[model samples]
Target: MDSEKRNQNYNTYVEAKVPKTKFWQALLKAFVVGGLICCVGQLFYDLYAYWFPTLSEAQLGSAMLSTIIAITAILTGLGIFDWIGAFAGAGSVIPITGFANSIVSPSMEFKKEGIIFGICVKMFSIAGPVIVCGVVGSVLAGLIYLII
Candidate 1:
């Protein structure tokens, strides 16, 4: 067979093997999972507020963030985050938990190598860019606000 015909035949075979996607079903799953994660964060916020009635709103929010990050890191270490990510898809990715998973996942995976070269190095590989962008963006925003 000529190269053109062979390439066409290969493409056809690959397309045929592709699985059918259920758009609505996936969207529904993502919405539910994402909402649940948010609810959990809210619950922590409420608990913190109740327990520390004198705390400021910002302090309460920080506590909630810490709780969520701890929970996400623990789940990632336990290998449960993978299953959650597989099911939730974008739902999981949109939240802070997903960021926790990104940091913890690589560290856990590379811990076998060593602490300094493996866990520490790999830990920030994924999240480093995000932190950098976030910091730079905030700085730029501050500068713009000051200028205006």
Candidate 2:
């Protein structure tokens, strides 16, 4: 009975300390940030298309994605991306930039440990599972299509 009371008290304390979520505000922020990221990608795509008029659509897309990833990596290194992520929540997390940030962040955090174990290894810690799942899913989808 004493342990039960202590547990109940702890639960109440934790509940009181938790911040309240503002659902609509979060949704709006996410929508705006995500939309802005997509707009930036589109702008890059347009610029690339204009600069390399002879390039195919796939090439233009690849260039645009590369630009976004580079920008995201730079921003993550500078520590600006974390601030944006904190303020925007999932707003900053649903885009390709977020994936870039995930890869860069762990590497930056662990860089002091050394290049091989720290930067190179930790760089993929968050992204490794995601990459694996993406590859597996794609292969499965391709196999299903072939079967069908």
Q: Name model 1 segments beyond 4 Å from true.
A: 1-21
TM-score of each: 0.84, 0.86
lDDT of candidate 1 over 57-107, digit per residue (tens): 999999999999999999988889999999989899889998999999999
| Cα deviation of 148, candidate 1, in Å | 1.6
Error of 2 at 2 (Å): 9.3
Alpha carbon lDDT at 129, candidate 2: 90
lDDT of 2 by residue, 16-77 (tens): 99999999998998899888988999999999888889999999989999999999999998
Displacement of the residue 50 alpha carbon in candidate 2, Å: 1.3
**Candidate 2, superposed: residue stretches over 4 Å from native:** 1-18
Listing every candidate in turn, what is its Cα RMSD in Å to the true structure after a full C-alpha superposition? Answer: 2.7, 2.4
Task: Report lDDT (Cα) of residue 92, candidate 1.
Answer: 91
